[model samples]
Target: MKRFWNWNQDGDQRQLAISGVIAPDSWIHDNVSPQVFQDELNESQGPIDLWLNSPGGDCTAASQIYTMLMNYPNDVNVKISGIAASAASVIAMAGTTVSMAPSAMLMIHNPLTIVGGQEKDLDHAAQMLVETKEAIINAYELKTNLPREKISAMMDDETWMNVNKAIELGFADQMLGDDHQPTDCYSYSDKQSDLVVLNKLKRTSQNTISVKSLQKRLSLLSH
Candidate 1:
């Protein structure tokens, strides 16, 4: 069987399924290129069901996919079967109707990058990042009327939202399939708490090593 998100149009709905992770060499960029996306859009007889479960990769590639979906004439329904994080969430917002399985998740975060350059080069990279972020924010805003500040905060925190939470935040228009609740909803506070515990353990281990070093020094001095 063909993998999901690889531009397989042999489904029941005569709808194309775009599923799986998003990366430069991923199905979106390799198997389903821009031409393929245009062909699919031109030939689609009905609504397109986009199943997203990806950590997200390749901002440029994801942007291409997002643009194609947004330009499609037919209705585009995005179903979050597992998780849509990072750039994957940008594509999801392009769907005319966004829904999520009761057990599925959606994550939104600011675009991140690593750069090494002089001050001027770094400034240019920073500007590009800002533009990219604004583009993503515009897409989300178009889909849901949520305030920019709210969306910005959520993205800054790398917020994870379950079905109900997604609906409440306007990330998802509805919930599909099952009527189950998510295991637990986490906020930035929860992440911080976990980090605190981890830091405490590290500090305790360091103190133990320091005491051992002091003991060895005292023994040597006595000798």
Candidate 2:
């Protein structure tokens, strides 16, 4: 069986890299089980630096990993090196401090599951999904402190965030650098309004703009 997580000793800190789909060995036949991961984590020494890059897979596996990390005695700092999407985003919330590379991406969306049965079974599945989404919201809320309503809406929209947006929304604490911090140049109560302005600038400039530049342009527009 292949391991989903890789652990390497780096001086006083242990570096853990979590890449690819998250699933139990029984499901994938080649993926590491959560218990196996727990065993490795239990044996580790010093603080952990976790590097995440996954498209997400089983929610149950993610929840187990998240719980394990949350319960670990040492600090676990998560660094998003590529993308953390869907169930992987939930696991990312276990970090004591989360950081993202400048071009890394973070995505969140409503939970989905397949059901096969009669109408009653379908109804039960729907309820399960709803409850599952709320559980995911709990993780995001704990990390970002964003309102549940907003987080739900964003999930409904299948929100995708770049490093700047992740930091702005508190999904990530900072950019990966010695002096990087969350961008605070602009704030908007309405996400739609923010998107409109961002879309307008994208069209006008025919390119992406930095948060600082966006702030300057927004200020000019207000004046």
RMSD of each: 20.2, 11.7
lDDT of 1 by residue, 18-114 (tens): 5565554644336546565567567755667777888777677678878887666556778888888888888887776667887888888899878
Best by TM-score: 2
TM-score of each: 0.70, 0.78
Best by lDDT: 2
The TM-score of predicted model 1 comes to: 0.70
The 10 consecutive residues of candidate 2 with the worst lDDT sum are 179-188
lDDT of each: 0.67, 0.79
TM-score of 2: 0.78
On the 0 to 100 scale, the lDDT of residue 52 in model 1 is 81
Look at candidate 1 and give me any clashing residue pairs.
Answer: 5-19
How many clashes in each structure?
1, 0
Residue 84's C-alpha lDDT in candidate 1?
A: 82
